[model samples]
Structures are given as structure tokens and as C-alpha cells.
Target: MICLVGAGPRGLAVLERLCANHAGENELVIHVVDPFPPGSGRIWREQQSPQLLMNTVSSQVSQFTDESIDCSGPIRPGPSLHGWLQSHDSDADQGRRGPDDYPSRRLYGRYLRWVFDRVVADAPDTVRVVVHRATAVALEDADNGQCVTLDDGNRLAGMDAVVLSLGHSDTELTGKERQLAGFAERHGLRYFPPANPADLDFDKIDAGEAVGVRGLGLAFFDVLALVMEGRGGRFVPSDKGLRYRPSGREPTLYAGAHHGIPDYARGRNQKGVAGKHRPRFLTADAAHRIRENPEATFRRDVWPLLDAEVRTVYYQALVAQRGGSSAASNFLKDYLSEPDDPGTLRRHGLTASDEWSWERLGQPWRPHEFSDHATFNQWLLGHLREDIGHAEVGNVDDPVKAALDVIRDLHKEIRLAIDRSGVIGSSYRDEVIHWFTPLSTLFSAGPPPLRVEQMAALIECGLLQVVGPEPQVRTDPTGACFLIGSATIPGKQIRTTSLIEARIPKPDLKHSANPLLCFLVETGQCRPYHIPDPDGAYESGGLDVTPRPYRLIDAAGVPHSRRFAYGPPTESVFWFLNETIRPGIGSMILEDADAISRAALTC
Candidate 1:
């Protein structure tokens, strides 16, 4: 018997494998636990907001290891994206592509839940599944097996092994964190902690409010999307690009991340983006150059090489047609389309006359013709009829968002390293890990962790009015909510009363400040697959577990087994989420069920 914690995707995957991969008619009882039932979907996919899009494409999101195994699709044999979509919608057969690229994250969540249910239904008679609608608070060991403690009074007494599937955790607050809020208790502050945004009661919020958003990143974008698109109208990314209409009265968002002003760049080369999954641009020349330069940091040694390659790949397709008369016409159109002011002609502004174009370059197929914000905007409006509204969009991507993307991509690179069994603690490994580790809790931590700088910026701007510097106090926008001292970033650790059980970060090695930091400002549309990430924290090998709400404790007290755990409150632990489902547990249930079936086997 085993216990699996957290009913998220990873937990469910383990459970499915347990049942399907088992050979003999061995009896095993699997315990699945979570406040939400097995199918409620994890934080990332389970969404109340339709506007929130997935980071990965649907074609890339199946549970199977093989890309060809497309069970997540609408049909079994429909491994290719087109086949599956056409099967689901007969009308899709007429089109080359139909809403298949980056489908909704909300839809993907539903798909995961359905898969979980199917695995349970098809389980062998030798197996029994149990689900606990509770959080696993603690892990204890006793006697021959392990003890799994649920938040409620109940407990699971024994288990052989626990495979942890805990998801990302929240990043916490640090120094001078809550002072701004505490100081402005009499006034107001807008501290929107990362929680279930839909669960919030928006009516309580006043209209025509001026708010200062702490981070100018995707989370900030989520905030904006929620306010604009979620408030009323639907959000859709179309041929026209990101479009948003009136969502009641939009708030005046005052966003201030570390990079106060975002730096914009000319659109990068698009040749790589044309490839299926975006090709890696690790050239021999660049590698040699990097290896040769003694003082080479990635910025000095590799960026220029990558930049040139990306541009080459991007413009290569257009070489033939670029010399045509339309090129001049397009250039004229680009100039004529812009507003009189040069500042208004920038890429970040949603309305900027930029674009994504396609033309039959004298060679094979349709090659891209234009690649700038103005051209992209024009293409979308003319062809797709979509437009993303930005009151004052930055020059390039919001710098903080770009930084996070770098960190996120760095994690992918690290995964590649792990897959190759690459050794760590080397210059490269250390460089990469530094970017990813900080994001673990954000990827999993409940009641999301805010950075110290995020906290400081709010306080400095008087957006979050401060009270007690050490022991903080603050007031919410509508004056309906008030908070005690929460820490600020850099030293976002503070101890006070009210709301969450706030704890300060310890000055241990785990929380030591990383000095080798690079504020990578831009990752143009043409970023290479190999650049090191700035936001990635640490890369460890033990178990690539998420920063889950539950804890993973080794069952030292279980006398029979060497390393076993009762497991986290696995969402689908009952069937087979932790080390494959077995058909035995609470011995009597297995004995009786097996005995009845075995005797009937004679018939």
C-alpha cells in the first residue's frame, strides 16, 4: 500500500502508471488525498478566468512520454493536431489550422481530470482506491509502516513508499516588507496577493481607483487581463493579435517593477520561430568563441553571435522578395500608419503600427515579409481583426516579465542537463541554477510569495502606506481590509499579527542572497535556446518536486521498509498515483474482495 500526495497532474500520472504497469494480481490499496477531489485540476491549469492562456501549446501538453501518443486529444488515433481537431469538429477539415495551436489552459485542466477518472475506472479487481478530501499536514512513522496525517483528525496508518507530487510554492516577503502598508493604515494600499483571483469579491472594490501594481511581469499582466477581459468581455488572441474591449471601467494601473522603464528592441530574426518547436541556435563559432574568451560571461561572449544568427534565420526567407517593389510600398505603409509622435511609434504600445507578415518569397511556401510591432499590429487588424489595448505599453516586453521568462527557460536548459546526467556545481551549472531556485515557491507555494523589492517599491512610492517598520500595519483600498506588518523584499522578513501566519526568512545558506545576478532586460523574439537564465534559483537532483502545500517526510519509523512514506494528500492516491496502484490495503478489504473473486473464478 502507498499514499500519494497532491491531486495535481504529476500525482495523477504516477497513479495511472501504477495500475497499468503492474503485472501480477497483487493486492494494493492506494490513498489519494486533497481538499479538492481528484479532478479539480491544479493551480496553473484550473482556471476561473477564460482569458488566462497557457504557456505551452496543447500539442505539447499530453501526459504520454511519446509525442506521437495523443490520448489527450479528442480521438485515440488522432496523434497529429489536425486529425484530432478535425475529428472533434467536422468543420476544421476545411482549414489548415483551427484553434489548435495554444489552446486554453482551462481546457487542458479539464483534459487532465478526465484522464485521471478513466485510469481509476479501468483499475484491476486486485486494486482498491481511497480518496481523502483533506490536506496532509504532517508525516509520522510508527511500527512496521508509516503514518500519514491529514489536516482533519483522520490518519493513514501504513504505506510502503510515497512519491511526492507537490506543486510550486509561494515566494515570501522580506525586509521592511510591511512598513509601507502599516504606515498608511489611515489611507489605502493595493496589495493583491496571488490567490484565487476569481474567489475575490470585486464589487467590494471601489470604481475609478488609482492602483500601483508591485511587479511589472506576467502576474501583472494577469492582473490587467483579469481587470479588463475577466471583468466583462471575453479575451481572445486572434489573427489580429491580443484584443481587449470595454470591461466596465478600467483601472489606472501604476505598475513599477525593478526595471522602472522597460527597454524596447527591434523585432528579432524570426527564422527560428518558423521551425516547429523553435530550433536551438548553438553555433560552433559561438561555442568556440565562448570557450576561447577567458573573460567570457554569456552576455559578452555569446549574445552577439546568437543575435546575428537569429536575424539571419528570420530574414533569410525574405531575401528574394525583399528586393521587390512591395518592400518599398510596405515601408511607406509603415511610415504612414504611425502616429505623428516618435515615442508613440514604439513596439510596447498595443496600438503601435507593428506586424507579423507572410509573403511568397521567390522560393518554397509562404515566407514572412514584415517583423515589427507596427507591422504585427497592422497584420492583425487587417487579417485577424484583433487588438490588445495598452494605455502605455513598454518598449519591449516588460523587463521583469522578460527576466522571469529567462529564468523559466533556464529551468528547461537545466532539465536538459539533468536528462544528459550532466554534473552540477560547475561554472555553467551554478550559473544556471541561480536563476531557477527563487521561482520554486512561486511555481508551487500557496498564497504566493512576493519578492523584497516588490514589497519595497510599494512602500517607497507611498502606494502601500507604511506603519510599523519592523512590526507592520496597513489598510486596503476600500478600507474594508487591514493587515499587520508583512516584510518587504531584499529583507522581506517581518513578524507581526493578523491574516496569514507570517514568518521571516532565515539567514541560512538556503536563503542566502545570490551575488552572481544578471538583470537580463531583453529576450527578443529571437532568443537562443541556450542562454543562461538570470531568475533561475538552484538546480538540485534529489527529486524534482514542486514547492507543494504539503511536506514530504521519509518514513524512518516504518520498521519493515527502508525508505517509505505515507505520502502527501495525493488527489488520486487511491487508484495509483504514488509508485503505481496496488490492490491491497486495510488487509480485510483486499482479502474479502479477492476471496469472493477468486472463488468465482472457478465458475
Candidate 2:
């Protein structure tokens, strides 16, 4: 018997591969365990409100292996999310969703369920799949093989191997977060720690209450939708753009982050599902050469190549927009010969204003200081409007968006240069993890363009306000409320009794709140991955595992022969852990799953 823990997308991928590689001679019993439904698991469970939508378009997501995935196992072609919706008439309302439209999370959950059912129905006769609706709280070595204990007090014994595909999990609060929580509890205020937004109770916040939100990433967008639209407020088209119609049930929200701006809206999907930007500078061969150097750092080596890739795409689009295809070709030829020369661009009729830099784009607010909140707010609003305009122009047509989208497209090459000892230890900790990861995420992983449009409308209607850059949140004991201020805007602060942390907790194995993870650590079944730097070691807060099959490394530095782990839980071991499988791209998730399945079966 083989046991699969956490039946989310990662676990589902393993099951698909197990069947695909099955020899069909011996009987195979697979036990799938999770408290939530098998396919959707916790976060993507069908119970979420329909207002919460997926960040990816429907045509891009898939649950099955396809021709694009390079794996040793046999490919099992299946429908993409859009294709599945087209066939399922019962989902007529959602079935009519266009390829480019974002589907509700609940609808995606339904699709996951259908995919799970389909995988089971098509499994070979030799394979028998049993799903348990209970969490696997503990695992231990048994006399025969291994044993998994469920939350329901049942035990599945004599398992040949087990795979832990635990996705996003909650972690204990940090020192600052705990202090804030204590303050809120003492004063009868509401403090929401980092969490899945769908699980938060937004209704508990009183109407017209002043609420301070402490993150401006994707989670903040979800909170905005829930507290506004979910509370009966509506957004309608106006002469200028969108106008908010208040239901008087919305909270006055002040949201901000280090950058003091919402994430950039995703560029419009002019490229189809299979469309991709071919990298010229940041190619795999280039990355491999960088990996050969012992002194390589992301800033010193990788960023130059990545920057060139972005500039190449940006100027290609910009020149094409101005002087058409033939001009773009000539510009590319000259630009390739002298990538750093400004003369090449000027020769193509481009000015200094046309130059692109990732640093300026990533931290646009750095060069100026706002005297007060009003000045910052106006400046921010203009930035949002400009971002929306570029988004509307589409990723393919817009020069800026096309350039920024390179960060998304060249992720595989990026991973090749940074994941698992690709760079020096100090460089990995400081340059790659601390600096580059967040910057890339902010630039590439943003909400739908429509969401940003609604955000601008909310700000115009006075329902939402953004605190200035590098915001600091503190407990104002004198006022018995939370105070949020920005270092950039001195003497300006917003006070509120309700404070919501609109972000997910970073994965920390040492302080994981989940009983299963805690048990694993306490029992020495696993340990947290640590990154060594010249100064000191940085705790990665990810489960340490072997490279290929990803066997969980024990506390004593030994890989467990019969155990494996992947997905978000093994994030530091693998770069870019949170993305779903795209149909026509080579998927790391699928590759990892196939390797683990083959290893598990052989064991």
C-alpha cells in the first residue's frame, strides 16, 4: 500500500503518475488522506464564496500530464480548465466563461473534483484508490514498512511508501504579531493574523468601522472584494471609469505595504494558453554557465542576463509599436550587438524617456518623498491609473507589460540559476531570497486587471486609502487602537480598532501550527532547511529534502528511504512553489510527482 497525504493538486498529480506508471500486474492500494475534500483540499475547497476568483485564466490551468511536460512516465492527456467547462453542461453558467475570463474559486474546486473522479475512473484494473476524509496527523516506522495515523484514531499500516504534499499551512505568530495580538485581546479590538482570506469572517467587522489592512498583495485584493462587494457594495461603469455604489455596509479601509502600492495588475492575456516568450539572453545554457562559477551571485551574474532579457522584449515591443516589424528587426540586430549602448536605441528613434530599468519599475516611489497623505494618495492613484492603462493595452502589445511579463516567462531559467546551491550561500540568502524573490512576485504575480480597476474606483469613492511607502504598524496604547504610519510621510498616521494582516504566513517548519508538521519535527522525522551565509546561517523555514524524489531529510541528516515531501512545504528546496500547472509548459510539479511515484512504487 502507498499512502498520499494532503489530496490537493500536488497530491492529485502524484496519484495520476502512480496509475500511469503502474505495471498492471500486482494489486496497488493507494490511500489518500485529507480533512477536506480530496481534490480541492483546504484552500481551494468548494465552500469559498464565488466572489473569490482565480488569478490565472481558465485556459491555462490543467490537472493532467500532457505533451508539454517532459517526464519518464506516460503522458495522460486531459482537458484544460476551459475545455472541461465546455464539456460539462451542468456548469452552463460557468461553462459559458470565455478562455480569458477568470473563473470563481468555487468553480475551480468543482473542476478539481471532476478531475479527481475522472482519474480514479480511468485507473488501471490493478490499481485501487481509497480516499479517507481525515487528516493524517502522524507517521511512524512500523515492523513491516510504515504506518500513518489519522485524526479519526484510525491507522493504515504496512505502507510501502508515503508522500507528503502539504500545501500552504499556518504558522505560529512572530514576536511582533504576537505582541499585536495580545494588545488587541486586552483592549477588545479585532486583530486578524495572516490567514487564508476565504476563512476570515469579514462580517464580524462592523459597517463603517475603520479597518487597517497590512499588506497590498493578492490577499489584500481578496479582502477588498469581500469587505466591499461581498457586503453588497457594487461597482458600475462611470464616465471616467468605474464608480462605486456604497451599501453603507463597507468598512473604511487603509491598506499599505513596504512599497505603499497595490501589486501591478496582470497584463491582459493577448497571448493564448500555449503562447510564451522565448528567452534570448537568460537562456538555460546561459544559466548553466553561471552555475559553473563558484563565486556567482544573483546581483553580480544573474540579474544582468535577466535585465537584458527584459530590455530586449521591452524595446522590441516599443520599436514595433513605433516603426513596425522591419524596424523592430533592425533594432534587435543592433541591440544584440551592443546591449548596454544607449546609441543603439537612439538610432532607432527612441529617446532617453524610452529607456527601461527594473529597479525604477520595482521601486518607483523611492526617488520622491510625499509631504502628506494627500500628496501620496494622488501620486498613488495616478500610478494605478497608468498601470491599468498598460494592462488594458495587453501584455503582448504594451512595451512595459511585455517587459515585466519576462519575469514570469523566464522563471524556469531563473530557478535553474538559483535553486539548490546554484549560487553561493551568502548570495542565495541575501540577493536571491531576501531581495529578488519579493521583487519578482510584486512585478509578475498580480490580480486580474478588472480588480485593479475596481480598486481605483474604491479609492475615488473614499472607501479605501493607501498609507505611504515603508509603512509601520504599532499599537497605540494611549488611544487603545492600532496606529499605522509611513516613514516617508512623517506625522501622518491612521488609527483603527480593527487590524487585518492581509498576507499569508511565510512557511516556517520550526513554528508550524499544524499538528502533523509539528509531530514530524518533534519526532525527528524531518528538519527545517538552513542556508549558510558568510555572516551566519539563515533558516529557510522549509522542509529539508533530497533533490529528485525529495525524501524528507531527518534531524540527523539522513534521507528517509520510504518517505517524500514536496509542494509549498519544500519551498526552499525548490523555487517557485505556488504556481499551478500550465497546460503547455514544462511543469516542475508534474516532474517531481512522476519521480516520487516511480520511487514510491519501486520501494
Candidate 3:
């Protein structure tokens, strides 16, 4: 029997691919384990709000690797909110003129559960796949095979391979984290975890209380919905977003970050493109041009574009100063007041760090056009080490020299940003605070009326308030915390507490989180951009201030012993470094119970 420890999309996917791609002459049997009732885990089975939608459109969500239905282009082309629901109605509602908006994550979860059921049905007669609706408490490898101990004190017999397709862990509220909980606990504080999309008990809170949110990221938007619209708040339209009216008394929202609010999100309001495209600020050629001479290129082209994107605000005595102007008659008011210059904002609003990244994405910002963009980031920093510039490093706990490494260089910039904010403070602290927040990435894709409406309804209902902006957010003293995106660990920081160890069925503990490492092994990437951690049974890299070892060795040659990590959960990147939350990717996980069974028998 092949044991698939976590039966979320990834586990199902690994099972499906093995079944579809392998010579299944020897029937495969899959022993799928999870605490949730079959089909999906808590992340998918629960944690959904009716109003909170998947970030991606429906065409992009599938559960198989080889069986993909093309999604014409990157700019959202698929079944939208109306299209999905229209299947129930007459054909007339299909073309109704409205926002072809995103749908709730709950609906997407339903899609995943359905796909899992279909996989279970199509397996060969020779395959015998049994799903255990119990938690896997312990796992260890034996010479004969792998032994998996379930929560019920029963140990499943030997298996050829074990796969961890787990999902996000419950947020273990720390002392300080609890202090945040206490804020909403009393004065009727409503707590919102950035990771969860579940419907919180916003009703426990009446209107007129000072409702505060811990992080002003996307989760904050979901919380904004639960209070404003989900409960009873009504949505009214506005240029900035949908305004809300309390079905009862409204509460003032207290949104605090180290930097108040981000300016990058909300998107550009420019109209009448230069030709057809929305201004080709950056493309592959732009990257190539900058590659020729990094510093000069940044000062002229790159710095100008990004600087225009930044929003500056310093509430010196609450005058609501914006971008160096002490007035805001309206969003359009500022336009008429200021001269129509292309790069003038770069001079007044853009700060030093802004200048730093200005060169990062380069003048032409078509991310899809360039692949080796990271090389440019390393080169721009003056190539700290001559022999190796921006190359990978190994060694878990050994210190890496900051003056000579790419990872070291990035980490150094992170530390400097943290320290500078601590001392002199960033010129555009509020902009940086908002940019780094989860909201920055989520809304970066695009925002529709539905989401903004949800927030507005909460406020109008007297259930939400517009707590003014913050200048910046600081890392935990150690900086081990992280910020997330949908399917990537784009952001990293050292925090007060981090995972130290993990226990998996296939006990070849290894660094599994670095997406690059996963791709190298060809085992599979973690579905939904997160490493599985059911029951917190996996090991992790220790929380040392110094950088841990990061390596990429051939899996076949790597020894499977206690001293080394077999696959993720043992090395520096154990559980997904998924600071970015991209849950919509779950539907594409394939399910093949038979392949898992055969792998258990042979490999």
C-alpha cells in the first residue's frame, strides 16, 4: 500500500499522475489520510466565506497536470461569477452587462471536492484505493517499507512511497498574537487571521465599536466583508470603492501597519493609452537595455515609473497630507492641482528604496518577457563576490557572508529596510508598509466592485470605519516572519518562532519549500503554493539569526538518513514558504490511486 499522508489536492495530484503516467500492470492502492471527512481537508473543506472569491478565474483551475484546458491568455479568461451560476438559469443571463467577476472560494472548494470524487470513480479494477479519515500522527521509514501511524493508534502496513499533500496549519496565536486577539475580544474586537477565508462571527460585534484589524492585507478585506455585507451592511457605489451603510450602528475600522497604507495597489487610473497598450512601462527589451548599464538605466527610466507609483503621506497633526500636498478635494482634484508632468512625482514622493527596486523590475516591466531577471538584481548590487554572483548556497546553520552572496544580499536589504525604518524611518514608509502587506499582492492582480463593495457595505452599515493609514510595519525583532502571495514564497523574514522539526511518512527529511528544489526533484510542487503540515508533524529549519544552509543535491545520491532531510520539512525550507496565499490553484491537482499503489510495491 502506498501511503498518501495528506489527501488535499497535491496528494491526489501525485496519485493521479503516477496512475496515468506509469505502467500500472501491478495495480496501485492508495491509502489517503486526513482528519476531515473524505474528499478535502480544512483548508478546502472549510475556511470559506460566501462573499470572498478565488483570485483567479475558473478556466485556470484544473486538477490534472497533462489534461489542461487552455486559458487563452493571462488576463483572466474563464467562467466568471455570472457564467458559473448561469448554468442553472436560461441562456439569457450569460451576456448580461456586469463585471465578469471572481467567485467565492467556497464555490472553488466545491469544485475540488467534485474532482476528487471523479478520480476515485475512474481508477482501474486492479487498483484498490482506501481513504482513511483519520489524522496521521507519526511516520517513519523501515527497511521493508514505510510504516504510517494514524491517529487511531493503528499503523498501516508497508508502502513503497509516501507523499505529503497537506495544507495550511492553524494559526497558533502567540502571546503577542493573542494580545491582538484581545483587542477584538474586548470592546467587541473581531479577530481576522490573514490566512483564513472562513466566515468569522462578525455578529457577535454590534455597530459603533472600534473594530481593529491586525494586518491590512487581503484577509483584512475578507473581514471587512463579513462585518459590512455578510451580516447586514448594504453596498453603495463610489469611485474609490463601494461605500456601505449600516443595517445598524457602524464601527470605525482601526487598520494599523508600521507604514499606514500602500499606494501601489488600487491600480493606475490612467485612461487613453499612448496607442493600444496601457503604456509599455517595462518589457523584455527594457530589461535588456538596463542589463547593458544597470545604474544609469535605473536613474533615467526605471526610477521614474516606480516613483510615480508610490503614494506619500505624513499625517503631521492629521492634515491628511498626500504626496506632499495638504489638500484632497477629490481623487481628480490632485490631478488638476498638479502640473501634468511624467516624472515629477519621482522627485517629491519616491524614496531611496523606491529607487532600489526601480531598477529591480527595470523600465520595461513585462514580467512574462524576461526569465533571468534575478541575474540583473545581483549584477546591479555590484557583484559582491567575483567568483559567484547570485549563486546558490548550502549548509543549514552555517553563517553566509553578507558581502558575498545573492541570498545574503537580499537578506541584507531586508535587514536594512527593517533597521532604517526603526531609526531614521523611510521617506515613503506608508507606501512600503502597504506594498509589503498581503493586500499589495492580492489586489495587484486586480480588484473588482464586489470586493470593494463588501468593504464599503461594512463601513456604511456602521459595521466598519475607515481607520486612517500607517507609515510602516516592522518584522518581529528577529525578522523570521514572512509575507505571502498565492503560490510562491516571494517574501521571507526571520521571526521569533518558526518550525524546527517535522515528521512525515517518508522520513527522508529535506529542504522542500524552495520551489526550485521541488522542481529539481520532479516529485511535484506543493499544490496551492503551500507545503502540507497535517497535525504539525513535520520538521523544519531552526530559527537562527544567521542564514541556514540552502543546497540542491541530486536526490538519487542524497542519503536517506536521520542526519539529512528526505524531502522538505527537514531542511531550511520545510513547510511552504508560501507567504503569498494562492488557493485557487488547488483544482488542478490530479488523482491516480493506482500509481500510488504500485510505487508502494516497487519503488
Q: Which structure among the candidates has the greatest lDDT?
A: 2
Off by over 4 Å in 1: 44-47, 67-101, 180-188, 194-204, 233-249, 258-312, 315-414, 418-603
Between candidates 2 and 3, the TM-score winner: 2
Clashing pairs in 2: none
Q: What ranges in model 2 sit over 4 Å off?
A: 90-96, 366-369, 532-537
**Clash tally, candidates in order:** 91, 0, 73
Write model 1 residue lDDT over 503-579, tens digit each, in one string. 22221212222110001002110111122224442232222111221222222211222222122221111111112
> Which candidate should be chosen as best, given TM-score against the real structure?
2
* TM-score per candidate: 0.51, 0.97, 0.51
Residue by residue across 1-603, what tens digits does model 3's lDDT show? 567666665555555544444454677777878876344455456345565655443433445432132221111122323333544343232332223234555555555565567667766666677888887765556777767777688888677666555444333444654554454344332444334545245555556554445444455666666655566656766774445556665444544332222112221112111101111223334434543442222234433433332221111111223332243223224432453442433434433443323222212222322123233222312221211211122111111111111221122122222211111112112222223323323223323334443543443344433222231222233333321111111222211111100011111223323222233345421211111222222222221111111112233334222111112232122211222112232121121222233333445
Distance from true location, Cα of 320 in model 2, Å: 0.7
What local lDDT score does residue 159 receive in model 2, on the 0 to 100 scale?
97
Residue-level lDDT for 66 in candidate 3: 27
Better of 1 and 2 by TM-score: 2
Candidate 3 residue 417 C-alpha distance from true site, Å: 22
TM match of model 1 to true structure = 0.51
